[model samples]
Target: MKQPNPERTPILLGQIDTDNHIATTVSLFVILLVVHRIGISVYRLYFHPLRKFPGPRYLAATELPYLYRNHLKGDWVRDMVGLHRKYGPVVRIAPNRLALDGSIGWPQVFAHRGANQDEYAKVRGFLFPGDHEAIIAAPRDVHRRQRRQLAHAFSDGALIEHEPLICHYVSLLVQQLAKRAENNELIDIVKWLNFTTFDIIGDLTFGESFHSLDNSEYHPWVLTIFETIKGSAMGRFFAAYPIVRPLVVLSMGADRIKKLQEHQIFSKEKARARMAAGAEPGRRDFMTYMLRDTRSGEKGLTTNEIEMNSPILITAGSETTATALSGFFFYLVQTPSAYDYLTKEIRSAFRNEDEINLRSTSSLQYLQGCIEETLRCYPPSAETPPRVSPGGEIDGRYVSSGTILSVYQWSTFRNPQNFRDPDSFRPERWLPTSHPLHDVRFDNDNRSAFKPFSAGTRDCIGKKLAYSEMRLIISRILFRFDYEIAESQDDWHTSQLVFVIWDKGPLKIKLKPRTMTE
Candidate 1:
């Protein structure tokens, strides 16, 4: 400061002035950003195209409301039900999204995928990373192509060949449950069902069994699948705010990302191996169709398609089936009379465990009714599968192109308008009108609204397989052992947190072998 050089004085002052200007610029920019955000929010609330839509003021303005209800609280399904109850079928869930219910929503959004009509495509956000390449995520045309190649494998005829694989694993499950019964043990039916279904899909898709039932422990990859889904469910929260994607990924932490990467790598390796093996002529598995795809011309799946879709198959095949079985058993143990009726139906229908097969089990009417009721009560898709409206009318309202529409399965299934006494476990509703057991009161419920597997072209591909697996596993267990809700788990259904799928808690049940000799 003493005797500062004359030449340096101007430079120092210039530096100070530049720093002040930068500070002022940054402050002004931040203020502008705040103002812009406030303005946009106001517009969204009162002046956006979706302004007239019925919804909470906060949700209509920002995603924060739905995120708070779904991601933060884990009561998203319940919250949606409440919302629809308050706001009617068409409620604006976000600034650009509407959740629809009733008969028209299904046919219009999911079913109307013709060249001449509005094809509300799959919401890309709901699917995996592969965009149109992933089967569940694939666009309409890509889905049609991919589905063509894979359709053979999931076909009723193909599943007949795959039945041996299912039966083989279900046999192992029976053996394990029989062991548990002998020990008079309290077993988590959900965990065991997961093990069975995972093993079957592992074998069917990957061309090898996870051997989880054989080992009595989940495969490391299976554990990874569960972890990945949890992360994905959480990731969906941040996905609602696309601007924060990178920040959300960073916040999800490195360990989670690494784990998800591991899952992908693991799946890739299995799929690659299966592809290398090629189809074994008559081998009837998921890989077989893809392996022979080149010969199928237009219907063939590419190597990349096969690799990505195998995991999707495993997930769609295994998780949903296990959820249905677990949910059925959960309701079964709670409703004593329904439980008694179903047990009688299954045991009486089959003389022995060996007598039950895919074809034979279909005749068990009461068992089928129970399965239907379970699907209605606790569907595999606990949340809505969001669809997009590409500028068309839906539920009597014209929606702009890219407007999101979702008919939440949980709310639609449970809505009083859809079903009478929707909360109660009543299998009688599913019984045919010709059946003496059928109820007119139950019949009065809008039967058309109960679409657990969903509807239209995008409906579940593995539906038949799912039904077969559920029927076989449930029938086997009921025949061999009598089960009751374990004392520790009360109100387990309400306690479950809904992710995209259910983060199902253990369904603890106490099993006792039926008196075979008596």
Candidate 2:
């Protein structure tokens, strides 16, 4: 009887043991994740591959320093240049990223053209309906195909054809600013710059206006887009790590995502609508120009491609021009000499508001120099543009595949090798001659090193339009007004995005109408 009881009763205990083992294993994994992240932090501080590459320890270990500087308006690029001066050009800016502030890394860095936002299946960039192409986020071949499809539009003839559209918007900007001056009201010059650029880009890309200029209140879409970008200084940190993104997406809901979806729908539908409307007797915009290119099987762009390309064009079209103008205005006001100089040039050139045409405004050399200096001093995107290596060596050292390297314009322009008084706003240095303080030879080397437009096969397609818009708007504004900063706000330095800068809050300045005559 005792033997029988022993055999029958014992088996149940084994099942409990197995379940405990599973529980123990799960506990160990959770503990490992905590340990692994800690190890990563510690190793970065000590044994990381790029440890010898100098930088502030916090930035090298993680993205926190970089993100914090952007939020704080402490100017990371400028800080980076300072660091490079202390450390060296080849500094580790983040755990997996390197900042090559000097000339060692160009051909090996940006020449490769790595994958863009579209390549990140886990994340998405702003999209529209007519195009699925990702100019800023795709493989080399994809960019080539897309750029080729749109290249003809940027020709001299095309730019000439696009002049009237440029002229019209500049006129609108001048009109609105003049009206404000007439009323003797203070306005945020930065906000108006936002309004002007977005509306013009909206009209050209989707054949619709964001109406920001007309409303004087930001369109919801414009606000959303700008907010997304505005948050990019921090957002890019979360974006790059990806470990914390799902938590964020879960927290923010799909509202902004849904709005982006709507933009794509709007882009595609507008393209279709524009095509259907056909040629009219009045005038042509970018839509009709693009329509003439495709004309065959669907002949225009497919909805997916339009969805991809439209928002990009709008982004490229709006971002740089707005930033340059904001920087232009800020510097002009900050350095009254430059402002007075520009004003004199504009006043001398134009007899009235009507005389500020696209052609008429571009004649002033000092104004152009100021615009260039503004871009150099305060570029929209100040960070190193992360690009892949071309399966080669940088400065004769071997580089592995998939290495994400970069050249930041802010840091590059500030480098002693590139400019004299690198931090100074000397527009005269941009002239054709060499400067005594700095060498200006970085403008056009065989490689795209100092590129705010990026370089090589993947340079920004909106460069021509961006220049036209910035020049036209700035010229007209200077031609029309004498502005002094509002008493309440005294600071002008603004925040930066991943590759763009958001200067939206306010540059409240009182406008005194210029006589339009010298």
Candidate 3:
């Protein structure tokens, strides 16, 4: 071998030095990253503002545990029930978040603000795209404006005008169930309820029906709506972990994403078409009321605002009513005493099916009680949208600014402190003490805690409409047919996964036409 050259030796030494520098940099970088994480965790555990609150230390140290359990696992509603039981009314669920039971928490956190107080801002991360424009996700001032404009459509006077249209669809529902009853078929009551409610809301919002009830099957768009709602949980998860969103999107597949986009497009197009058609005189559809304000040159929603809000109105009006009714029947048929009592109440109250209108149905005390209990047990909007604190007290505990809190509806309604025999379905629990049906055991139950539609200025505006729909539909169905649970679907209600809204499967039942004795 030739003698080593001076230049070659220098180059080899230089290469070794460069490798050593790269290794040292990477080692230092990794060490810093680990140290940073540890420092943050320690801060969260020992020095965070929420450190005094009771909760799993891991959850308080990192949001990962809460996000993993609630969002990824789709078990937040069920999990909250256990969490509140273990940690009491106030629990630190994340480093910056607390879950409040609805009793004192609902009033303190969600009640109307005082003169000097600012509204607790909504947690933006919980919303889906386009939701910011809708009343549900609008900023405080924006929400007030939107609510004012939209309030007329849901007014008592407006609902009176819409009654005939509502009755028409309900009649169609009864007729459809009659056919299924004649066949002795196992009817998926959930699907039928969905069809009825979707058609009603579609007609009210679009000035056209989805024809789901007429077709005796779901419209493609209606099917897509359910898919979109289920996918919202995953969307919320991605929103929380934006760094992982790109990877999650890739795994979600293009078809699913495309379907969601198509649903949005469909809603936008329908809204546009409704706008172009112009309002029909004496027509009381939702658009007609919105157009009235716009045409009168009042501070009403813009054309774009109308389009943005149509999907919100449709989903809010339809899915929630359908869910409540589904839960109503699920609990009703299983509780034979409740079933018999309600059926008697309905039959005795109405001599002819035609007489069972919204007005007549409202007077059925037991029916009303049953509906109330159903709402308590299985609220349509089962989870509360998280609200950000503005550095105030909640349930007598001080919450720092930017802290996230929510009165989890599932936990509140099911809490033993709020109700007697909380897990059991007892309509009497909702009756007043003076009522013959009222149970003494539930006398001390925290009745104020039973806010299924929520409370305060931001409460659900469509509450009156929802109650009317549920009462009319359930009373009519029970009056027309005698039904039984087709299969042992005891877990049908509880087995669902909450994705903002419930991801409910089929509720199967068999119906027999009740003989009319004039």
Candidate 4:
């Protein structure tokens, strides 16, 4: 063996200082642990902190289940209910989150603002992240200002003025259906409903519609939005982590950002032109109302500002309405008796599609019930929107601030505690005067339990308009032709692409012409 070099050994020993390496490694780990611990503590004890309350373990800790379930599974809403059933009224879901399936009331929860707008603001689909004062993204004061400005357009008089406009589309829908029946082509009710809705909304709000009704397929943006929603639902799952979002957003494709920028630009330009005219559009529409109102106010919302919010209004107003219509028609086909009954009522009520105006459609009580039952069974949006607790006692239960809470229309509507034989489709359940469904708990009361259009300040702003559109469209369709689900059954239980979900596949139906013989 060669003699050892003492100097070399000492030099090597300098490199082997474990104390410094160990300290560096340990310090890095400690820092990571501290950061992680603080984050966890915030979610668990502060952010939507419901230490004493309960829900599914995964849900309480984060929106992972709520976000993932709808996108990932068909029975998402039901699964939450299942969790509710298993865990009781309040269940701790995540490290600190809670899901409360309250029965008596949850009014204050829906209305009050929590910690900040973070409760609902987490739902970014309403508007993009921006400094602009869009109605949905604006601070409370700005939202109030914007909403007040928008009120002129959604007013009853505005609605009546627009009655002819809506009626025109209803006729156009009838004509399109006639062509389909004549061609012996099967109808994808989902496509047409959205087509009509997008068209109507576009026309009524944006001064024009894509005229999707005339197309054999959906418009590109319609397809894009549907994808965006589905994408968002999936994104929401990862968003629960909070740390993952920045990395994901940075990696987003240039095309998506470009498209969003394009849409924003288009909305801005259109709104400016409308505002510059200093007159509402000649046609009765949302922009028209907005234009008229902007004149009265000293200052106007920037074009970009209105643009940010306009899409949301059209989306929220029509997408939900259209989904409700598609689902309603889907269920009606199964319930032939109810279908026949509604057909008889509408046909007897009106002579032609032209005769079926918004005012006329409003008179049909059974129609209203049919719409309600469909909404109750297959709510437009998969969920009622989650919120953070307002930090107070609601219905005698004390909830601290930052509690992640959601009021589910899906669960509330299907709940046996609220409705009799809740799963069954029963339109008569909502008859005005006398029905077996009546009870002190919900029915015969002004703000009752069967609220498909929720209640109070947070209630749907487009309720009346949605009601008019569904009634007229469905009424005319059912009256003119009868629809039956095809050999391949239509399924409403699909992974929700958007918060406002539709069936996985088209609602394929054989539309048979209704005549005296039939």
TM-scores, all models, native as reference: 0.92, 0.79, 0.94, 0.82
Off by over 4 Å in 2: 1-79, 102-108, 111-132, 230-243, 246-284, 289-301, 433-449, 494-499, 516-518
Query: What digit string (tens of lDDT, one per residue) describes model 1 on residues 370-403?
Result: 9999998899887656877789876677788988
Q: Per-model C-alpha lDDT, please?
A: 0.83, 0.64, 0.85, 0.66
Ranking by lDDT: 3, 1, 4, 2
Task: State the lDDT of candidate 3 residue by residue for 1-518, as single tens digits.
Answer: 88999879989999999999999999999999999999999999999999999999998989987776666567877888898999899999999999889997668877888768888878773745867677887888788888888898899998898999999999999999999899999999999999999999998887789999999999988887887775666677777788997776687654555667778899899888888877663566888766665435774777777887898899999999999999999998879999988898899888898999989998888898999989888888888788888998876778999998878788899999899889888999877777788888888999888888777788889999999999999989989899888667989977887876778989999999999862
Clashing pairs in 1: none
lDDT of 2 by residue, 358-435 (tens): 666566677777777887777776654466543455565555454457667777777776665776777766555443
* lDDT top scorer: 3
lDDT, residue 505, model 4: 57
Model 3 compared with the native: what TM-score?
A: 0.94
Question: Model 4, residue 368: displacement in angstroms?
Answer: 1.3
Tens digits of per-residue lDDT, candidate 4, 441-482, equal 445323255566654445567788888888888877877887
Higher-scoring candidate on TM-score, 3 or 4: 3
Query: After superposition, which runs of candidate 4 have C-alpha atoms over 4 Å from their true positions?
Result: 1-49, 57-76, 102-106, 111-127, 137-139, 234-266, 293-297, 434-447, 494-504, 516-518
Least well predicted 10-residue stretch by lDDT in candidate 4: 118-127
